[model samples]
Target: MSLPLISRAPGSGRRTRRLPLGALFASPYALFLLVVFAVPLGYTVWMSFHRFYFTAPGAEVDAPWVGLSNYRDVFTDPVVQRSFFNIAVFLVINVPLTVLLSLVLASALNSKLPLRSFFRAAYYLPYITASVALVAVWSYLFGTDGLVNHALGGLAPDPSWLVNSSLAMPVVAVFVTWKNLGFFVMLYLAALQSVPGELYESAAVDGAGRVRTFLTVTVPGVRPATTLVTVYAIITGSNLFSEPYLLTGGGGPDHASASPVLVLYQKGIEQAHPDFAAALGVVLVLFVVALSLVARRFTEKKEG
Candidate 1:
C-alpha cells in the first residue's frame, strides 16, 4: 500500500502542501496597513485640499471642493503658525544637545569605570518609565509654589512655571530631553561597543591620547549609527504630541505649547471636525517626511 501510494504523482496543490505560516501571519498586518493606514492616509490628503470649517454644527462647510484652501488656511491660522514655529524652535534646541550628551555619556560608560552598569541603568531609567508619569513629576517641580520655589527659600521664582508663557516651551524641551536621553544613550552605547578594540589599541600605540583616539577613531566608526539616531530624533521630534499635551496641559498658559497633534485633537474632539483634523494629520506627516529626508542628506554629506 505504501509503495502504491508513492507510485502516484502528487497533485499540484499537494506538491506545495506545506503552508507558508509566515505569510499567513504577515498578510493580516499587510492588509491592516492597506485598510487602516493607506486608506486613511489617502482620505486625509483628499480632505486637506478643501475648505472644511464649520458652516453650522450639522451642516457641511463646503458643498463644493476648494483645492489647497485648507492648507493655505492652516499656514495662515495664528495658532497653527505658532505651533510650527514652536516645534522648529524645540527641534533646533534639543536635537544637537541630545546628540552631544548621548555621545559623551556613551564614551564615559565605555571606559573602565566603577559601578558602570549601575550608572548606565540609572541614566536609562527615564527612558524606561512612561513619559506621562515623567511629565507629572516635572509639573510639580515647576508649579508656582512648588518645591523649586520652596527650595529657593526667599528668592521668588520670578514667573511661575506651568503658567508662564516664556518658560513653557523650554520646560517642555527639558522634559523631552530627560525622557529621550536614555534612548540615545542606549544607541550610542551599542555603537561604542561595536568599535574594534584593535583600532583603539593601535592608535594608542602610535601616540594617540584617549581624546584624540576618540575623535579620530571612535567617532568615525560610529558615523552611520550617529546619522541614524539623529534622523530618528528629527522624525520623532517633529511629531511632538504627548510631551506637550501632558507637560503643558494641552498648550496651557495661553496655548504657547499647543503642538500640531494637540491642534489636531482640538479640531477632532473639541471642534468635532474630523475632516479638518484629518487635514492637520496630513500636513504633520508631510513635515516629518521632508525633515527626515533633509537630515538624511546632511548625514550623507558628512559621510561622503
Candidate 2:
C-alpha cells in the first residue's frame, strides 16, 4: 500500500507546496529576450574590446588585436572632443530654457483663459507631427527668405540656421525645445492641478501674491514634477542623433554638430567599422548613465 498523503514528515521538504512548472514553461519571449538583448549586449562589449574590420573576416591572416585602443583613440580625437563640446553648449542653453519655459507655459495654461483648450491644442500640434517633417518646416522657417526673418522686417539677418556652425546647433536646441516643451508643459499642468486649492487659499490669506505663492508654495509642492521634467530632459538630450543627423546632415561642416550618437552611426555605417562603433556605443552608454546619475543626485530629496 502507498503511504498516506499527510503521513509525510512536516520537517522534510515534502510538505512545502510545489509551484506549477507550466508557468515556468511560459513564452518563447523569455528565451528571445535572453538571446536577442542579452546576447547582442554581450557581443557589443566583446566587439568593443577588439578591432574588427570587415576585411578581417575575408583575410585568412591573423587580425591585429586591439584592447581599448578604440576608446583611447576616441578620447584623444579632436572630432570626438568637439562633439561633446557641442553637446555641452546645447545643454547649457536649452536645459534651463526648456524646463523653465515648460513650467511657465504649464502654469499659464492652468490659468483661466479664453479659448484655453484651443490654444493648448495649437501649442501641442507640433509635437504630434513627424520629427523629420517638422524639422524640414523649421529649416524653411529660419531660412533667408523664410517667414520669421520676413516678419522681422530685416531687423535680423536670416543667418544660415542649418549651415552655420555657431548658430546651427543653437537653432537645433531651440527647435528641439519648441517641439518638446508642449509635452513637458502638459505634464506640469497636470501636476499643478493636483495641488490642493486649500494651500493656495491659505497662502493668499497669509498675504502671499501669485508670484510669491508660486515660488514658495507651488514650486515646493511640485518638486516631484520638477524632478520628472529634469530627468526627462537629460535623457532626451543625450539621444541627440536625430537633430544633428537631419539638421546638420552628418555633423555639419567640419563636424561642427556631431552628436555622440551620430558619430556612432557614422562609424558603424560610413566607416564600416563595427568595433569602433561598438566602442562609441559603450561610451554613449557611459555618458547617458553618468548624466542620469548626475540628474538623480541633483534632484535628491531632503527629508524634513
Candidate 3:
C-alpha cells in the first residue's frame, strides 16, 4: 500500500523558492548601503534643487523652494571658483609628485638594502597616523618661527610657509603627498612583486640597462597600478580638507587653500545653509567624476 509516483502531498501544488545563500549573506551590506549612502546621496541631490533652509525661530524643518538659484550662485561665487582653482593647483603638483616619488621609493625598497623593513615601516607611518596629529606636527614645523624657518638660516627672512597666500597651497600639496606616499608605495611594491623576474632577465638579455628595463618592463607591467594611483590621487587631492583645515584653520590666508569640502563645511555647518552646501557637493562630485574619467582615458593602455 505505497503511494503512486504521481501522488502529491496535500497543499504541495506550489512552492516558494528560497533566496540563495550568497544573497542572504549580502543583504545586510545592501541594506546598510541603502541607508547610509543611497539615502544621503539622494537627499543631497534633492536638497540641491530647492531653496531649503531651517526655520528661523526653531531652526527646525525646511523653508521655501527655489530652483537652480543655489547652483547659479555656486558657479558665480568667486570664493568657490578660487577653491576649485586651488584644488586644481594642488592636483597638478601633488599627483605627479606622489606617483613618481612612490614609484622610486618602491623600486628602491624592492632591492636589497640595509634596514629595509625599518625604512618601510617608517615611510608607512605617516599614512596610518591621524591627520589631526600629523597636521599638529606640520603646524609646529612650518610656523613662522618653526624649524623650517630656523633651518633656512635667514635665507628667506622668516618666511610664512603655511600662511602665505602664494605658498600655502604648495605647502599643503607637499604635506599631502608625503602623507599619502607610503600607501601608494605599498601599492607599487605589491604590483612590482607580481611582475616576473623573467621579464627583467629577458630585458637584460636584450642589452637593456637597469633604467631602460624599468622604463620598458617595469612601467608597462605596472600600468594597472599606475591607473589606480592616478584615480586615488585625483579623488584625495580634490576632496582635501584635513591638512588645510588644521594647518591654516579651515581656509588658508585669504581662502587661498580652501577646498570645496572646506567651503561646503563652512556653508552647511557654520552658516546653516545646507541647500547651498548640497549644491557645492554636487558640483564637487561632478568635478571629481570628470577628472577621474580624464585620468582613466590617459592611463588606460590603448589597443592597436
Query: How accurate locally, in lDDT, is each candidate?
Result: 0.74, 0.74, 0.81
Give candidate 2 misplaced runs (Cα > 4 Å): 1-26, 55-64, 111-116, 194-198, 293-304
Output candidate 3 Cα RMSD.
10.4
lDDT (10s digit) by residue, model 2, range 188-290: 7876877789999999999999889989877877666666555665556557877888776777856787777777788787879778878877887776778
RMSD of each: 9.5, 9.6, 10.4
Residues 37-113, model 3: lDDT tens digits: 88988988899998887667856665557889899989998888998798778878887888788889999999889
Residue 20 C-alpha lDDT in model 3: 91
Put the candidates in TM-score order, highest first.
3, 2, 1
lDDT of 1: 0.74
TM-score of each: 0.78, 0.80, 0.83
Number of the top lDDT candidate? 3
**Better-scoring candidate (TM-score), 1 or 3:** 3
TM-score of 2: 0.80
Residue pairs in candidate 2 whose N, alpha carbon or C atoms collide under 3 angstroms:
none
Candidate 1, run of 10 with poorest lDDT: 1-10
lDDT of 1 by residue, 58-136 (tens): 7754535877667666677788777777776677667777778888998888778999989888998988898778888
